[model samples]
Target chain A: MSGFTVYSATGCVRCKIVKGYMDAQGMTYVEKDMKAEGKEDFQKFYAANRRQIFRGPEGVEFPIVTDGTAIRQGVGACLAYLYAGRELDGFFSAGTLHKEWVDGIHAAGGNPAAGEKFLAVVRLLKGNNFKLVVDTYGRNPALLEKLLAENLVDVAVMEVMASAGLAGAIFGQPLAQEDIERSVALVATAPEYRFQTTVVPVAEGGQARYLTPQEVVAAAKLLATVTRSKKNPYLIKLYRPVQPKDERLGELAPLPAAALLAYRSQARAYQVLAEAEKE
Target chain B: MAYPSVYPTGVTIYDPKKCWSGYTIFQAKEAGALLIDMNGTEVQLWKGLHGFPNTILPGGYVMGHLGLRNNAFGMQDQTDLVQVDWDGNVVWKFNQYEYIEDPGEEPQWMARQHHDFQREGNPVGYYVPGMDPRVDGGNTLILCHKNLYNKKISDKRLLDDTIIEVTWGGDIVWEWTCSDHFDEFGFSEAAKNILCRDPNMRTAGGGMGDWMHVNCMSVLGPNRWYDAGDERFHPDNIIIDGRETNILAIIDKKTGKIVWQVGPEYDTSPALKKLGWIIGVHHTHMISRGLPGEGNILLFDNGGWAGYGVPNPGSPTGSKNALRDYSRVLEFDPVTLQIVWQYTPKEAGFVHPPDSNRFYSPFISGAQRLPNGNTLITEGSGGRAFEVTPDHEIVWEYISPYWGKQMKMNMVYRAYRVPYEWVPQAERAPETPIERIDVAKFRVPGAAPLGRKKETAIEGTKPYQGSTALCIAAAEEVDEK
Candidate 1:
């Protein structure tokens, strides 16, 4: 149980490479060729695992590497877990989270923390036996607002970004500084609403230039002043490249350790400013 | 006692009761009649002597030959090349009569012009002229128009047959004649004479012939010998199967020599022989790559041929006949020459009476490996065609409602499915609307002729009026004679 079991078939190049890597890392494991021995037993195990994790049957393929508590169905899944340096046993054993739910959140740029939070909310609602409903942004907002007023959902996770901020980034229409102030004022009326900003590095010329830490801090302070809110909102800096195919972005160096430290310091300073304003 | 179970891929039984009339199209009976669209309904495009029924390729185009019949004194069959659109319009046609001649003698054999027959003046020759014409790449026409007769010739030497590549306008672009390279009498003289003496060797029921009669031609890709850097995956090669010799050969179009061959050197490997016997196979087609069960050769293994192994008595042709009851689609690895996959009715969960048997006749049947991983096989003798899935389940079945009789013979040579897209927009017809008529209200015409005097045959019927019944009886007698 301390070691791993790598179920593979003969003539699979990927399986050989994976086993070689494990050996180099001094990890002991049991190897099984499903084709030569225990084909039916392996199929039964595979089907059982699939039913537990996925609602439908998974395609039958070789090299299902399992560490007693966790199973990786194919090479792609194995590689992803190896890079993450974490086992999915806890999440799977909980029986409350599905792989598809986690994958969907990840696809939409939601982090692991957000995924856990969403699962927790779903569990709470289900335990209460409430008929929960969810809709996309394009759905009728008035109906959603009505449901919210009726106290149908004890908690709701909604996505909100400044319209002016998005239009400026996507359509190259620069918004005046007052537009940002006005947007904050408009959303401040809703007590449950939270403002979210995604920080993406923009490439200009040959170097990736992120919004200066001082500028972010100043914006945060100004927003708090206009909205008359005391609590600093959560700022999630998503680190995906703005343009996938831009060669300049790839050439640019990572954020220097010193620069990252400075950014964190500025964020802390904004938190202090909001706290002081609340007092 | 329990028998070992064989699991099928899947089975889907189609019930006619749940089906609705989809469409109806009429096919003409001309020699090379093509399906054409007239007023939105499919009609045959009848032109100069149509002979063979059209064959549908992966695309919608139908390819077949045009000719009357092969006989001496120029009364023999001459092949006319043709490609018909789905709506039965002749998109292209080529006439080879000018270059071919039917010398006054015995029935001019179509095998004479094929690439496996020896040319005239060769010590041994088996040339039966005017045989099978095949079109490849929608532009090139490969004709196996000759045959050879020589006993001592090695199977490879039978490459003397000519495979002519002509354009749509009848221009011979390139030609490969087998006689120039291989010697017809290269084999032991005894083997040569025995093959020549058997005049009926090429016929289906004749003893095995020596000469490899190239019946079908397919081009693989451009010649790598001429242009080593040619990027095309398929080279310009031709596939010829000798019906009499039971040889499947691939001839290099450029060199006109046997590049690769199966049979004559075929042996059932220990593994395959342990499972079952697969003797003579025909209508070999290359299953397209990347499809389910791809990279294997699909063939109609007429297991009835009594060549190398002990013949199964229950074969379709009965005992003592080479073609008996065994027929199945076999997928074999071309390189390893191993039978990898097969489908028989028993494996598909169909139980038949002890007397019912199925087998393939090379000249009379066609098997198409379809894109959906099912095989469309035409049981020519029974005049039945069925679409079978990978699991050997019959999803679609059709019995030819129109049976042709040649001198009181009921035989179906071949049938092909015309994909709806291939028909030209102007040629396709709107679907025929089905209307049901009550049979009880139907009446027999009073003017109908009867061949004999009316009798009180029915228990409730009285005798017909004398003069009228007499007149009807006389009219029926005249019609009967």
Candidate 2:
């Protein structure tokens, strides 16, 4: 018996896409249309596993696939699982830069085991000559140092939370200022690397204000110091607080493109790159 | 990133069997108070009755404000607090609190009410089986704004919070102002200095210091603690939380003194460490006597930013000092401060840290304990309301369909789940089970294609070791510059 069961609904373009992708891959599976002949069966299935349902902004997504061993809700999550271990253009790995400290960060409920697994995957990709991209907060200097020394990562992006002094609060954990400085220095040594910081309104005393241009320049100065060059690339991306999540942040008007351009001009010590302006 | 403009609204998911099914009422962002059924049907709408948060009283009566005050002279002031019958006729009203005059507008009596108020019968504004809010008689506790200055708390004119108990005849029989208890909060010298200088100063009302912008207030009602001789949890004592100061306190009804409290400093205690720095909190109250975890404090820890403290690197002046990225619904023993139960991203079945924001509402939200073991949460910032079982399974969910014209967003201040019988004006809709739609398969017509090209390759490019264009958009952004 084929273990795959795709619960789809009629008129669902994603259903068609998922089925088409499966057919393109020569995979066989049963397609049950919840809005059509398979409605009753889907209801029964939903009743049995309602708690496992993942409801998004729209509703329960369609083309839910069950492989006997696992259930995948979205097309992206489903295909990623089905294509696991299959060849791809490259591998993207996170949670590896701070192997040990990953367990200490409470904000994301740190998982050292998961960090180890991610590091192992990076090693597997690099050992097999596959390209790798590493995105990190750059909290752990020694691990980053090792990763850069081994030339294991092709492209590395360090999300600079703040200048050395203010980073601990943003990270939700304190680190020696020297450590943050060292991580920036290590990331600078990568074959391809850039430092990015999302400019958001910092609320204090019940009011909010965006990080001043001088503050942005202070970050650029950190990059300049670490790379020992005025040409080190620094990106200032505007913060977009997703609703219901960072709605309070959403209430604050975003820094206009003109304001961002002003920051870029002020931070002349580094190659400052601004995010795409909101239309 | 641009978000999808089109998505499902109204009742997205409903499991009637698991939910404490009843009429869900809230102030729609557009105008008027809307009472929606379990299936998202509009059972009734009181068109001209606005709500900072509307509450449904028994016998088909709803209480809200008549209209809002002009922003030029007031921050969140309402014209009057009124109770309207099923047909939207004003039954009981109170507006004799303060008479205000704004330049270019006629001077009139204003209630100055903003966030919350509770009729005598129910301790919390929400419904309890045996504790329905009296429709005709009983005192009402109103959270109102009063512009004053104490120089002790701030140098600027302060938009201070004051709780008043008015009789059925609109007489202000009792009153308690927040600034009187500033020293009770145990602020450090640095915190005190910062507060005296800023006090959460705002531009509203021509630059007023909105010190201790208290967002929630409720009575203790009859509870196990008071029954067991805890005078601090006296049935009549009031509970209030300051959004700007990070303080949840209970005021003695008789003495008007703070009898019990938490914060301004949360990191010092072990019990507080369980739920760190509940900044910008709301809807704090003792769960009514009959509900689960009765006598325990239930509050929405609106984790955004709040508090006063010493200068830190992130906040140089220590104004609005505390911060957290996610929200949590906490039920804790007010005395021991032991967290009894909570709902965070983990309970919502999302991984922590990364998916934390999936369960956040930084400001303006609330929670209510249900008769069953579930808790109804109003994540008002997103205009989302839902009931979750004690195990944190979301049994029913509703997203507000009304978006405000001026705000251009649907943001509910608070929502309450009341028994269906409370509003007899409309017949209860069928408790149908609305299954969660497959968001993956759900689509808006004329939307972008669901499938991308199998290969988005830059053809004939020279290869380099470990080279991949994962962030093609970022590359484009750099090229644009």
Candidate 3:
């Protein structure tokens, strides 16, 4: 089982970091949306999740992840567990988890004992494990295209970070409209891909500061124009505040489930397969 | 699909710096009341009948309703409220409307006690040791519901919520009913109109309307205000919240009058304006004295399906969408009527709009004031419980791994943090401090291959991590700045 479950939420910088690290190491995972279908929905799995991870003492937070038999939770713990799990499972061990990741999990639920225990118990040696998502193609399109061309990508994840021209606010810089469109055309048109929008409610001083859900839908339709096939799965990845010295950012919330679903339903009208990946 | 066995399971989270060290006791859906240490380890369990909203007595005894096999929507139509020891031994028991029995121990019987209860012997309860201390009466306060049809109170048959004080010998020492003071709830013209037309207290299954489903009720014990001679804040007064009508009130147990209240009309008061719209609230109680921030009213503001304002007749017949959908934990002073502190998902670094349903649980959940000045919260819908410091740092967190047998939902009604001494055990486990993780630097152990699969033995993997230069098209080095 070379695959892991990427339990991620939108606007989660930790999720993005995990994605980057996974990309660098060539490790694959199945990105499960906490928003769309939750871990709780599957009762048996949830029961196992508790029995396996919680020992009546510590627990990992969101971005809870697992590679078949080996599971990790919280951003830091998941990463450390994943790193240690991969190496102990004998599939891969070249990439070293950052000391910070290991330390973070230790605090968040990842201690050395837990990391090692997870490795010993996880049997990621068999399963249809594949690198789940490949991200933000608009910012790193060329890198994503190369992965696709070489068939390294399973579900080519194209994150629509922002709706068209307003993308600069989220990326912290300007992204040319033409470049974003061209990238979407190239990546979304791939044989197999997932088009997603990490919808965040831009907030400043405890107030919303961005496009409304309807506007996002309009923008989503604009991006959907590039998709050559309606079969390409479309997603509304609900946003969370990404870390990086933006006090206003953490205050910025993900759109409400109603708004996200509204966006998804409207986006579906544009002939795109839409689903909500809320946290 | 089977989940990975090695991933983070439902472990208990304890951050020494933030959480108050204690044993958590809760009514697990299947296993009755469970007493566990902070690390998610089960210290003890009482596998007797249990239902939602269970609590712990001073000496590790557990009190909760016994769940049934075919309860509606997992709703507890509990025939009895039982108290058991750590070993699942039924120490004291009370079956509602029938008899109260402590067969093995004392062979005592009393009036049928039901819903919420607090014994005078328990310190993990409303009455504290100091401040406005009173004599130990060895009595218990209980919340009961009995159907009464009085056209004056309501045209339709109503589920009357009654609060009663009963002795261990089963004497109903003092009692109060909803219909007796139906005029005291301060129902607005609109609320009155609606209630008069049809209380709509009926459940979805066409059952009797569960009007004023009083899930919790606690007597305001000794506090700074009461000790200072505030007759209204007298130790014996009671506080309760109605889930259906969206009202929270403090009852003057003496005069049998509502001394202070909020709701039935929030838009009219300026103080309430700052308090925000509290919908379908729960666990509304005065933080007992001797605890940090004692005397303050703390409640879990469940922003679920509840209302008093249904567009007011001609204003616009709004659907359920008119209601707000978000949950909050609020602590405020009853004197100044000012919000002392609040915890929304915003405190957890979540912004609304995108994470709309983030801090929301329309139905079940609760909050508790910790001795360490922190607040413990349980998001019942998600079955997650956590403790946040006064400044809102989650020092500890836990997810109930137990699923509800009847509802098949992993919803934990409530959990309380009882100090280690509360359990009559010889030894207690030490707690460890967990560091928050850094997701940015987390890593997996894989390295992409340098060349084709035939070269590395695996048929086809990606290029090596060191060879990103060879895959320039996909791994472009864009200046993030």
User: How well does model 2 score by local distance difference test?
Assistant: 0.76
Which residue runs does candidate 3 get wrong by more than 4 Å?
A: A1-279, B1-9, B67-75, B96-115, B121-137, B203-206, B312-322, B438-481
How close to the true structure is residue B468 of candidate 3, measured as C-alpha lDDT?
Answer: 31
Against the native chain B, each candidate's TM-score is 0.60, 0.92, 0.81
For candidate 2, lDDT tens digit of each residue in B185-237? Answer: 88878789999889888887789988899999999888888888888988989
CAPRI-style grade of the A/B interface in model 3 = incorrect
Q: Write the per-residue lDDT of candidate 3 for residues B293-404, one digit (tens) a residue.
A: 7899898888876654466343253212126667888899988779889998666665442344577777777888876788888887767788888899877878778776
lDDT of every model, 2 decimals? 0.43, 0.76, 0.61
Candidate of highest TM-score: 2
Q: Between the candidate structures 1 and 2, which one is better when assessed by TM-score? A: 2
Deviation (Å) of A164 in candidate 3: 96
RMSD of each: 31.6, 33.0, 35.6
Off by over 4 Å in 2: A1-279, B1-3, B446-481
Interface RMSD for each predicted structure: 40.1, 25.3, 24.6
Clashes of each: 67, 14, 53
